[model samples]
Target: MATRTSALKLLRSSLQNESADFRENQWEAIDLIVNKKKKLLVVERTGWGKSSVYFISTKILRSQGSGPTVIISPLLALMRNQIESAERLGVRAETINTSNMDDWDQIKQAVIDDQVDALLISPERLANEKFVSTFLEQIADRIGLFVVDEAHCISDWGHDFRTDYRRIINILKMMPNGMPILGTTATANDRVVDDIVGQLGEVEVIRGPLTRESISLQNIVMSDQSQRLAWLVENIPNIPGSGIIYTLTKRDARLVSKYLNENGIHVAPYFAGAEDDESTSDEHREKLESMLLGNGIKALVSTSALGMGYDKPDLGFVIHYQAPGSIIAYYQQVGRAGRNIDDAYCVLLSGKEDGDIHDYFRKSAFPSVHEVELILGELENSDGLSVPSLVENINLSKGQIEKVLKYLSVEDPSPIYKERTKYLRTAVDYQLDTEKINWLMQQKTVEWKEVKDYIWYGGCLMNYLQEVLNDEIIEPCGKCTNCLGEAIFPVEVNHRNILNASAFLKYSEFYVQPRKQINKGALKEYSIPSKIPANLQSEGTWVLSKWGDAGWGHLVAEDKHNGVFRNELVKAMENMIIHKIDPSDFPAWVTCVPSKRHPELVPDFAQRLADSLRLPFYPCVKKIKDTNPQKEQQNSYFQCVNLDGAFTIEGEIPDGPVLLLDDAIDSGWTFTIIAALLRLEGSGPVHAVALTSTAVN
Candidate 1:
């Protein structure tokens, strides 16, 4: 066994942690790495010093004249933390990632010369042709240790598994016999543990109790979005320290951050949603992380993007505005709180719309079999179309198209292959198996149920999570809301603030940004036989509410039943038209987007709207085909194609402006195509209106 004295010295000097001793399992894990030279899997809760095991071992091994350690990390944020930690230990460390493109050659040289003791890389880096062919191959003998952080992702059973992580399996097979491998994770159940162990061969398995003594877990069953917002505005200040508030979607994150900021809480939303701008840059994200570490802000409202790699020891509290989809996800996110402090609040506020939001997420995990077949058929028929070209032909979103191509192209037995940016079908006879897909669907359903189980399960919330993660919970935590019999309602209710939140939810003002680019074949398919003119577009298309918002979203979904509304739709439409959208130059005539499935529903609403506004109603556009639902088309460009020939002029229309109405605006493709038709015949301006905007949905 290695001497404990040297390990302790290195650990103290590395972490600057005042704890003179190591945790019970920390020393054993390090010994196996430095002494036994055996693979290991450490499954402990977060903040349990998993990084220290490898860091200490890297120092010991390097002291013994061994080679550098290579860590396969999942995120850039995680890489930054590891690099800084290694440097703190006096270990020469460097990272190769997208941001440091300029220094990659020099970093490569440093690795080749053995000047760097540790190197951090992402899983996606394994698939980069230049990286795999160059530095990775050259440093094969120089890598004494291979570490897979967030290793739960390597197992398909884990909730957050990335398909790219499969590369670790092949890398594992290529490792030399004596080199020690370590797989570490904070959330791994029995199935995930077994799957990870199976991938790494015979290895030491270290498990620990999943409960945290510092976190006081709690949950409140909120009635609606307004109540939750009001509660957050009133309650966040009471929480002990500055921490994170997790949201289910980017829209919610930004909205909540705005509301909190308005109510005097200094919080900024952190998410990776840029319509076309550069992605969340490393410098910006790092600065945010630093601010949070130093308590410069009250909190950061974020999605799961900020979950794994960040380390703020004394985070005050963590509150989830909506319940997570699974227990595993909840545990991993809530683990971020109370890492260093003795007590921190972990709260979850359940919203009625969470189910709707999660449904949107669940359906998109992998493309449907029908959708995949459509993409493959399109690619096979064309001569290796690039992604942008596929965007013109296929009906999938840019994100979905790229993901489908990436998964198929990266994994073995791929039926479709990419060559020089264009894709083509290979001789590999592969199709998505029905049974496997069905099983995956079944698994997802069970996971959703488990999330509900945690809420309604009476005994102990922490122990419930423990059992879910396959940990032994011998006794109740006695710290959660249920165990303590402590129910926290609105400590101080503000009737005015509550009403203000309700007003904000009801204040529905959303935009319909027109699609600037159309598929090459779409205009011809519609028989317009001309490019869409700039004037032939809905300039001020408006919607009353957004999908899953607090205000008209709930009323439209439940009251209108996502169908046609009577007085509510008329009143909301008039309110929007008279106040929100009054084009002085033209208020000509009114029309509605004809629906094949609900033909009478929309025209009835439109005719009523025309009478209310004292304008003539025209059935100007017709559904050309028994057209597919816009939702089914998955991609915006294809959505336009689906509606291309579906609309034609009712007859020779007047030369005045036209007001088009629809139940919901999905892709804005329908608006663009119909506007082209309206302008083609003899209509002035076309302003589209809808009850809600389901674009994000």
Candidate 2:
């Protein structure tokens, strides 16, 4: 036999055992260590097989026979996923966690005695006094390597922060000798990497790019509220795979999940603050796990509660019903898909109002020191406290309470936590008197009628409340189905079929669906309100009004750009009722020229707009449309964009009323702007309408 060098033999065997999931990019990382003798901190984007680095490293370390390896995991669910994968490969790996409460001593003994090759422990357990004391005293010198999973938590700026991370450096200090450190996380940013290195004291940085070439990202700017529901109904069936639909609130998560399930797409919903009806925590977890792993449930809708721990690599899509709090949040939420390096898509269905809604839900500032003191004071005597009890005792709002709890559990240094988990409120086997506890489950429903009413009849308050508060019972509407009549199943109705029927009925509704082929409103009547909807020529089309012409090119609303406008609109519309503006001013205010394509309909359309706006001029439709010529009187019907070309101020000209125009009333942006300006200029309230309402799209 030829004398083979050790490196040559190892290379030959490695090539022969190449894995299907391995990529050249992965090898580049391993090569830095194996060939260059450089300790690496490899960071790969989400779904890029970052786990392979360690799996391969395990063999390299075993061959070296230095010592056993240790992995620190953030969540028990995550630990299980990795442990199961290792077990299947005949790798001896085990995890220690609060889940195995009774066997903590046994697991600790294994780590001290070196009975385990690879051990996984939750961050909380790693910080445990008993665990830390034992590891520092006995096992500190035996460690081969340290793996920090979800290392992004080390950064205070990151969305998911773990307080336990602050002590990770301290733990490492207890180690007998310096060892190469690996920080792994899918959602690491520059800020996170800096924080990790700074906290760990000594570390090498290996950051992977955030871009995933295998994934496609699209932002769908829907025309109206109903279009989101319609898009799901139409496309969900064609693209069949497990997907996660993220919503801003639990109510929206539940409603969206229900709507998808109703439309033949079986969906399961996970919410942050939902009540569990099961008798045990395991039962609740089992039920949720069954729904996630079982067949037929192809989609799961949830809030951020589903973001941190869950892993199912074959996800086909992640749809954000609303924009997340930050771009980082947006990235992390969408990163859930394409984990297998397979083709997948992430679509964000955003609107002009998304940022405003996000602001309404985001924690505005850090929890005050006083607030934290109050919380600790309340819980000082108790071994553990439920969320509701904590909220009540601390006198903090529910939102504030949640933020505080998340901060304490994840972000704050030297945070206090109970060694207990909250299970469902236990029920007695004996029949007991039923009492309705002070539990409110707020929800919002997206039905054709509600969408239509919001666009055509309701004021800003109703629209704001409906969109912001869905699927939960926030406040009881005595008239709604759940309040008075019965709990209706959204499942009986088909969303797509309902939309198709509504589209066909547009003739009666004084609207027309743009032909599928002739987009850009080639027929003039079917044109979209915006410059041209990207999807118009492809699958669907809708009618738009004249104002859409200029309004479409205006700056898109975002939190950083148009927060002032949203705040002004919200403030002005807080107390006002919906009213229409006069028609005499409509002519100059009209942004797009009327179709003139319909000679017989000019006066008819004019009068319709006037009536919708409740304009005093052109009150007599017959007089305005009369063929006999009458000298027209001039009216103050124009509002001009400032000479500098900023948004035109809509107010009463010291001489008279000013006209405002818009393409449609989907979000009532135009109306809100005009209303705000008019209020500022002492012009009373705004009354306005479009050629047709665009809700129920």
Candidate 3:
């Protein structure tokens, strides 16, 4: 323990000496690395200094002890960058890959002799039989720390996946003893984290913030096609520094780069799968490298493959030529600009074309667990398969194939390190439920409710559902394209246009309209007695009663009728009120179904029922010229009903017990509306009850 502590202190000292570190973002991660002994999962966004945490952690581990530290990275370029950094800083770090195979014997000797403190290898290299055996025989028990960079690649759901990463768990077990692992990544959703937990078996998680505060994010909606091009030309030169322009396709990368070049911006373009010259050896590679490192090239517009090792910190901005398939991919591409964080900007030039791109990718992005299982089973039955073979035979998207490999590695660790041809157990046992997978897969494939074909529009689609359908579960997504004024397509084109064409409009309006004489008189024939529901026994309350289709009658009842709509009118009456509201106001709200239902009746039938029951109605008393000593003006009273739409009681009401009525309560909107109107008309705190509420839809 003393020796370990001392070594850690030395490591910390070395790191502090090496870099001019910023205290804020760097410290939180370093503290976690230095103090936390358990396995740590750093879930952060891109360009958030995920790598720096490990660098410091490695320094501490190497300084404190006689143990070896192995950093397993999926990207060779990333490994090379780390190695170069360590060399420049005069720290101990070395990488092993195909290029370094000639020195394999010397490297093996170094590890065996305990001369090297830190070694980096690809997951593919560690999974090699000879390498695993060598590590187990010599360096396994001595390893104090293990680093899995780009750890999300071990999950089937991560943005950038490599099938080989899944085998890492088995490699860990092959070590002499289990030690704490540090897994890191810039892109990991919840699903990816679950996969990582499964692989490490005994694990601890420490996630950083997903929102990058230093990076400015902007989304521009373009209607005209040429606007995007014009913006690109104007913005690129003004920024004046190293930057990346990301595009959806290789063709776009080529076109955009050419356009920029034609407009006097020096630019270079590279596509992921584009062919290279056959004759290009080391010199040819150097020539291509020069263009990237060349002074003339101001900006490089390309696909994701271009910037793996090209970490230029002075990048002014990152502009999206088109929308990437997923948010994770977008985050990853934009993250390239703000390395070391001196403040940078990322802009998305999104439009209708981008939506098409997103839809295409989302639809084609999913892979089947069955296909993944088959590929792995075949490899176990034979030897491990190459990426190309899996891609061809599985018939899955590249992203999907990567994800499957990631899942298998974490879920079934034993298979990762197996070298002999072994009959495989079913990989399906560890896969996600097929039904859920299908649902999520479908979500990614389609554009979510294109507003043009949608039912409601003023706010977001969610608000529309809440108002029109009375969906209690739906919520307002405050940052929707509608709310942000960031849409390429016209919103008016897709609105349901319900106000003009809807049948419920007129009825909803009439329910809320002020009536001068709801009841005829207090005379013998006008007063009515109705039994109220037990749930609403409160006096002075108003409720709407449904007599039949389009026959909603307002009843101001002192007590409840059984236990139903004690407040507002039914959907039928609510529709009438909505029709009265000017079409200009797009009201956004959510509501739950009311507790009551009632049958509708004709006006004559309603009047007859009231007369038979001796219900009292007070007529509007206008101000009289000749004042009778006993007669007083009765114009201060008002009654109201909750309709679906907005309406004001425009006239004076006769004071006294003002009874409000409309329709049965289907949703609470009726009650709220009635209560508000009653209050406005000097009806004092309203106490009302309702009749039956029948389901309309």
lDDT agreement with native, every candidate: 0.81, 0.48, 0.51
Could you give the candidate ranking by lDDT, starting with the highest?
1, 3, 2
The residue-level lDDT of candidate 3 at 569 comes to 37
Which candidate leads in TM-score? 1
> What C-alpha lDDT does candidate 1 achieve relative to the native structure?
0.81
How good is model 3 by TM-score? 0.53
- The number of clashing residue pairs in each candidate reads 4, 20, 59
- In Å, residue 81's CA in model 1 sits off its true spot by 2.4
Looking at model 3, which ten-residue stretch has the lowest summed lDDT?
Answer: 633-642
TM-score to native of every candidate shown: 0.87, 0.53, 0.53
- Residues 1-697, candidate 2: write the lDDT tens digits: 1111433343344335533434546666554443443335555656665555554555466556645667888765567667765554444677787667778778767766666667787877755565677564476676666777778776655556665676676677777655555677766555566767677765666654465433445555554435666676776676647777887766456656766765678877776444466535434543564566553467777778767546677777777766565555556666777776456666666545454454443324356566666666666567567765554355455566665555554422334553544212112222111121111001111222232232233222212223322212244334322232432112233566657533322211122322222112112221223232332221111222212111221211321143222232222221111212233432222211122223333344434444444543321111111121111101101111110122233323332333333233443322433333333444432334233343321
- Candidate 1 C-alpha lDDT tens digits along 286-356: 77777788999999898888888688899989999998888998999999999989988888888788887
Shift of residue 291 alpha carbon in model 2, Å:
5.4
* lDDT per residue (tens digit) for residues 1-697 in model 3: 2233443344445445533443344555555555655577876655555555666566666666637678887654467556765654345776777656788788877876777766888777754666677564467777867888888777756666665776676777766544657888766766678878986876767665554434555556554334565677666776646677887766557656766776688886765444356632333333333554443467777777654444455566788866665555665676676665556666667645665555655555544656556656656565566554444444443455555554454554234433353223344435445785676666444324432223224565334422322223344444434555674223221123222222221122212222222212211221221222222222332223332322243232322344333223344333332443333431121111122223222222233323433444322211212221111211111111112123334456545433334324443333444444445555433333334333221
Write down the RMSD of candidate 1 (Cα, Å).
3.8
